[model samples]
Target: MEPTSSAPGQLQSVTRALSVLGCFRNGEDLGVSEIARRLDLPVSTTHRLLAALVEAGFLDKVDVSSRYRLGTALAEYGQIAYRQHRIHLAEPHLEELAAITGAKASVATRHGNDAVLLGTSSWREADGHELQGLRLPLHASALGKVLLAWAQAGEGELARLPYDSGTARSISGPAELGAELARTRERGYAFNDEELVSGFRTIGVPIGDEPGQVRFALGLRGPVELMIDERVPFFVDLAKVTARKIADVLR
Candidate 1:
């Protein structure tokens, strides 16, 4: 078997411990033998690594089965990393958009077949509820459509379609979703006219490090009265500008 670490001295122990922790997935519980088999390590070494990780609060040992799973420490660290990397980088731009338009502004990144909200900003105090982990349907929300449009270019097809309908207007077929994505590409933004929720509208533009490669989407959403047809052009322009600003910061 290959050595766990290339660094000198005790760093090897740290590498083995990390490897042990990495073996556990979101809903999986593993014993030392399974981890050792996966890592091509001996049972005794794997048991030692697991013991250290459990003691250090990186893994938790189940009382009944004696299996190991990821601990709360990893989740706490993950939230910190997510805040520093995604939310901190995108919040300023969202705030600027929300301030200019007097609506809710958000940043989302593609997660599987959904757009996962990373951060949001709103001028209204009552609208300040957290939406950090919200997942919007790819075939329904403006933010999701923008990401799907860009991803389609590389994959040569849309993500498997006919997603659960968020509203009567939500796209319900592959062909319908394909056409919407085409329109999104041509118009340089995606628009949702009460597609996700009744009486609500949103416009979203992709954020990218370069042309034609989207990393995330920036969006503005509000009541239909405030996001009427006449106001869509202005919101689209604002969303695109804010997306560009966020891309610059991320780069």
Candidate 2:
């Protein structure tokens, strides 16, 4: 098969470089032979691609070794990526939640199959940062469940997917998950208590009037004690109120 170029300038070079970079996802520190074999390109082509990517700061080659790893250009790209218009707009809402809850509040959306944080008011911002870009699981988080339930379309969409979990407390299988999603749709929110990571919990509501179709999320995060304790129902109500406010602003 031939690689398609979107335009003429440096397309082939870019394609080859991307292919080499993709080799890192399932494994680490690949040398020329592995990259060439995985990408099915000639070793010479792979070497040239690696050289170009390394020069462009997209890949790094450690001294005294022939292996390659991701480089600074990707980090720069990530920084650039987190500064989109939507992320900027969502900050005020995240800030409101953070101020009220005195914890981390953020906005997220489906980035492919993963939930990507778009904006945040985390506890660490006084040290000179905000939660700009972080990917979280959609299958194992309160935010993730909200995203998925919304994606389910509220019309028997619940029954179609497999809903197994990575943790013990999670719904055991897809059938049960479909039923759980049915409930989530009824309540207009979702919760995760130590589901993704032990001792971490969250309550997330969709950013739009509708669920899965919403482009953003409002999330509250803290220790499990705070989320699962008596204050949780109140916090969920707070999150829902805040979500309605966000939807009104966007509407």
Candidate 3:
């Protein structure tokens, strides 16, 4: 007689396959043995799963190393998930914010050590920056700073500050970034003055009220001349209100 179990063999296979896929880290590749060791599974089982994933277009094998990494299929699914979880909920609010501010508006969510732009809104005649589907450095972009500031404090993974330079004003050290994050937390917003892009400025606010636990950020961007110190307060207020609206919809 066949053995009884809480999960059927097919379901177990599906779970194991997903676990194998999960082992591929961002910017890192893995061979079958490494994956099997991580999953605590037999080498033969891991190889079978990897082959199946490669066949299904869920993973790609490197020509030189024979290692496996995430494939285009994951990116396709990621975009779909981003649309469903973020873009659909944020579009109306971002549109209204852009209309009200006469500036570019965008929403972003943290992904690994980067901020992924999910949606953007711009005035009809405005030549705003197109950033949807773009991944930006966490220490340079206003939206990235906002998300990073609100990440769980003392989380070692979040503390890895790879301060890639976007402009001369970009944060270059962990100390400076930590101070900046502190200020962002205190002010309930983050500002980037030509840090990511020369001649442009941006301000961002978190979507939720809880500190150190934000999942989304809303931001406004415009030329530095247009987003002057005198006008920053107004834009910040608008961003906060719009963030609240988006949060309401998300909730």
Clashes found in each candidate (C-alpha, N, C closer than 3 A): 0, 2, 0
TM-score of 2: 0.69
Better of 1 and 2 by TM-score: 2
Candidate 1: TM-score? 0.66
* For every candidate, C-alpha RMSD to the true structure in Å: 7.7, 5.7, 7.0
lDDT of 2 by residue, 1-251 (tens): 66656466577777777777767754378898888898888999888888988999988997778889988998798678766443655568778877877657777777655677766774643212322226665656777677877776443444443445446776555566667667777888887777766666778888775533777777888776556678877888888887877676555
Candidate 1 wrong stretches, greater than 4 Å: 1-75, 83-86, 122-133, 153-159, 209-212
- Give candidate 3 misplaced runs (Cα > 4 Å): 1-79, 122-133, 155-159
Q: Report how far residue 7 has shifted in candidate 2, in Å.
A: 12
My TM-score estimates for the predictions, one after another, are 0.66, 0.69, 0.67
- For model 3, what is the error of residue 174's alpha carbon versus the real structure, in angstroms, after optimal superposition? 0.6
lDDT of 3 by residue, 1-251 (tens): 76677458889999999999878744468998999999999999999999999998899999899999898888899789866775677888899988887778888888877787777885444434543235778889899888888884454644576776688999887778888888998988999998887888889999997876689898888887778999999999989999999998876
- Superposed by TM-score, candidate 1 places the C-alpha of residue 48 at a distance from the truth, in angstroms, of 22
**Local distance difference test scores for all models:** 0.79, 0.71, 0.83
**Lowest-scoring 10 consecutive residues by lDDT in candidate 3?**
124-133
* Evaluation by lDDT, superior candidate among 2 and 3: 3
Q: What is the lDDT of candidate 3?
A: 0.83
User: Once all C-alphas are superposed, what RMSD does model 2 give against the true structure?
Assistant: 5.7
Q: Candidates sorted by TM-score, descending order? A: 2, 3, 1
